[model samples]
Target: MRVVIVGAGEVGSNIAASLADSHDVVVVDVDPDRVEELNYSLDVLAIHGDGAAIETLEEADAGSADLLIASTDHDETNLATCGTSKVLGDAFTIARVKHVGFLRTWERSSGAFGVDFMVCSNLLTAEDIVQIIGLPAAVDVEWFANGLVQMAEFEIGPESHLVGQTVQEADQFDLLTFAAILRNGDVELPRGDSTLDAGDRIVVIGPPERVYQFATTASPNDAATDTENVFVVGGGEIGFQTARLLQERGIKPRLIEEDPDRAREVAETLSDTLVFQFDATDTEALERENFGAADTVVAALDSDQENLLVSLLAKRLGVNQTIAVVETGEYRDVFEAVGVDVAVNPRVVTAEEITRITREETTEKLTFIEDDRAEVIEVEVDEKSALAGEMIRESIPRLPKGVVVGAIAREQELVSPRGDTVIEVGDHVVLFVDERVAEEVTSSV
Candidate 1:
């Protein structure tokens, strides 16, 4: 596909880097330095100009691009860029915005204005922080199709109950699957005989209700806590959204905004939460709030340096965990080195989201597939489906070609589908078919 990415920042560059391997990618940014860096590092066309300007977009041949992405830090600029690109081409356009008002009011409705999708950085960052805080032991969590299903990661600790267990013998956990393990930095799609040992990072996919139940088994029961008091630094859109999410979850949030006007506006909008006009960088102000008393400290300043510093300071001040919003990949290493517990790139998250919604039929949400030789697929059973009510073993040969039922989801419950397991109506079955026979397998399923 001919893809144009505006911004050339960490998120834009990461998107271009990931997509350039197979697609025609063009990166546009106002910064000549960034453009130069991306042009040499990635096999993508790099152009320097104001992306919000239609003229610059024309120079980059936006009219012919299959998709255009506006991912600059400024919400207005991103919206304008996406709008203008849509006018230049009938291509799908995605904009990265941060304002909650804009997200709630115009995101989906902006299709009339030529935007195919609107990604709110604040919402994405807040969601990431909330999930990470809720499941502190999990490395990552992703929900697909508006939370119909969730994917979670758990690193096998020395005391895990799963150590030395074969793939098939792992606790059923009622409705969750021991999907795949990331061991020694290698992904493995285990089978009945495959054994799991300590230090193996596992990725499990199931409905949220069951996933949370399984998560508790991996960690202590006390891991589930009601984070009632949230301290949010940086009263910008991201900070406000984070505070709003906390409030929605029945948590009382105290937001610290450096700008008095912004703080006043947020305070007026959020009657349920506390808004204070204070510099989060000021140790006196942090101490005044008893920042350590809060369950979580979110460092969401506009500047990456400030976010990193504040997060470090928060950690030093005895906060249980600190989350920082960073804009650059370089800062990821820096943040980790400085002991920041969690970091997120809003642009990268937004880009990944856009790609997911606009992806081709063969595309997968994850870049890393567990089994290179096998393909995992979700095939909904038609009500009148021939395979319905038939035992998997009995239907094995009757299947059109090469499909093998690995797992099945019926009424939001995941079951290890075996030869004796019978498929049912309204079942969303997952098949693990040999790559060579994936098409045949799907045709049969």
Candidate 2:
């Protein structure tokens, strides 16, 4: 497949890198340096021109492309690029935007902007924050098999009691599957005897309730049975959406916005939420409001630096969980390493959501961990599936070394992937696969 990606920013580059290996990728960028850099760094052909211009599309031969993605930072620019691409070709166009209004407009008529699919980064990032907050000590959370199966990543602190326990000892939850252990920076397949270590980021998949239960074991003190008193530090679109979603879940959170006008606007919009006008950097003001009493503090400020500062402040003030929205996807690790419990990157969220739509028909859901070191993907079992009609242990030999069958959803019931469990046709299997074996594992399964 030939893919044309507009904008050479983080989102566009990530999409290009992921698809470049298996498909013909052409990247169009207004920046000459980015175009030149992409040409040297990746296999894609990068063209220097305005992506929304007809001449640029013609030069890139986008009319014959199989897929066209517009991911510029500017929503108008991305929409215009997609509209232009439609004039050039019948490619399945995907546009990334930051506004919910555009998404609503497109939803009424999906092809309104000539975009086959649209991704709202702000909304996606906020939903991610809400989901992660719902789980205890979860660095990431993704649902598969129509919400029948769940995958989550948890970090084991240096003081965690599970540091020295083997995988077998840590397997206390009935429906949970220990997918893989992320030690240092590498992926390690979990074995019965595999010993847990401090600072290990472990991935688990199972029923949603069991996954939430395992979180208590992962971080007992921080994992609460109920999430109450969430603190949202921004009144931007993401923060507003997050607070609104939490309100819908019956959580009335306190929101702080530096701009008085925006705070007033948000307060008027969300009746359940309490909005305040104050700078998050003002420690005295935060202290007066009992910031330490919050179980979770989400920093969705306009800038990543501000969000990081607010998150660190929340941690310093004794907030159990601090979630921040990172504008740049690459800064996620940096934010996490410094004490942010979870750093939500809008670009990464949008890119991964877009990438999932580009997968094969068999793959129902896909999400990457630590930006592609590993992946948790859902695929349907067919007659040609290697594991079809076979017990999991019997099919292990056919799978790659790094593959772990996490969970299975047969019809509407959850099927635990035990050694003796049989995988029948039409079963949706969610598996954690190391990046090294993704292609081979997906092919065989």
Candidate 3:
């Protein structure tokens, strides 16, 4: 597949890095340095020009592209690029935007911008935070098979019950499958003898309820089942969306914005939410609002520095959980070190979504878990596939290490895979794969 990506920024570069080995990836950007960097680092073609221009698309051979992705930071530019690509080529078009209005417009009228699919960075980031808020120990969560199965990553702290236990010993949850473990930047398949250690990140997949229960038990802190109060800083799209999503779940969150106009807009948009027009970073304002009583605080300011400050202040004010939206991936660790519970990177989330859409033709669903160190994928079994008509135990030997079949959907029924369970043709199979052998796992099944 030839994938032409517009804008060689974080999102574009990430998508290119992931797809370069498997497909023909071409990236376009206005900055010569960005193009040069991509050309030097990745095995893909990079074009230096305005991606929305026809000549730039033509130079990248857009007509031959299987998919054209517009991921520039500017919403208008991305929309224009996708629309122009549709007019210039037969490739399927995808646009990344920060505003939700574009998504609503596209949904109301198909082909409005010639965009077959749209990815909203703010909305995606907000949804991710909501998922994290629901699950206690999950740093990241993704769903597959129409939400029937969930894959979550949990960081093992020193106080965790499973810190020193072997994989078999920690197999107390009948519905949960320990997929893989990442320790000190290395990926390891969780075998019966493999012992979990403090600071290790474990990926687990199972029913939503079971996964939530396991996460609560594994977390270092006492996990709360219900969040009574949530304080959201920033009146930007991400913050507003997060508050709106929480409200939809019957959680009325208090939102603070420095700008009165934005605060008024948010108040008008969300009737159930409490809107405060004041500086969220102001210590006096935070104290006046009794912010310490909130169960969770979300920092979604425009600047990473501001978000970091908000998260740190929230922690200082005695908030139980702090979730910050960090635009750049490099700031994630820094934010976490300063006491942020979870740092959500919108760029990484958008890139992962685009990559999944690009691979939708081959896999039913694909989720990058554990900081892209592992993946959970859903695939349909065919007669030609290696696992077709084979028992789970027989096929286990054929698959590469660090891969496990978590569940199977047969004729609208969910089946918990066992050693004796046979994988029949036409059955939908869900598997957790280590990044090192993801390609091998994908090809085999």
Local distance difference test values of all predictions, in order: 0.72, 0.90, 0.87
**Best candidate (score: lDDT):** 2
* RMSD to truth, every model: 5.3, 1.3, 1.7
lDDT of 1 by residue, 14-45 (tens): 66765786689999999999889888888999
Best first by lDDT, ranked:
2, 3, 1
- Consecutive 10-residue window with the lowest summed lDDT within model 2: 220-229
- Which has the higher lDDT value, candidate number 1 or candidate number 2? 2
Please report how far candidate 2 places residue 297 from its true position, in Å: 0.3
TM-scores for every predicted model:
0.75, 0.97, 0.95
lDDT of 2 at 219: 88
lDDT accuracy of residue 257 in candidate 2: 94
Give one digit per residue, the lDDT tens place, for model 3 in 1-445: 8999999899998898888988889999999998998899999999899999988899999988989999999999999998888877789999999999999999998878879899999999999999888576668888777778888888887888888899998888866888888887787777899998987888888888888888877874757645878899998999999999999999989999999899999999899999999988889989999997778889999999999988888888888778899998998988876678889999999999998898776689998975677788999999888889999999988888777888787887677788899999988888988778887778778
Candidate 1 runs further than 4 Å off: 30-59, 145-148, 155-172, 183-185, 190-200, 221-224, 258-261, 276-290, 312-318, 360-407, 411-445
TM-score of 3: 0.95
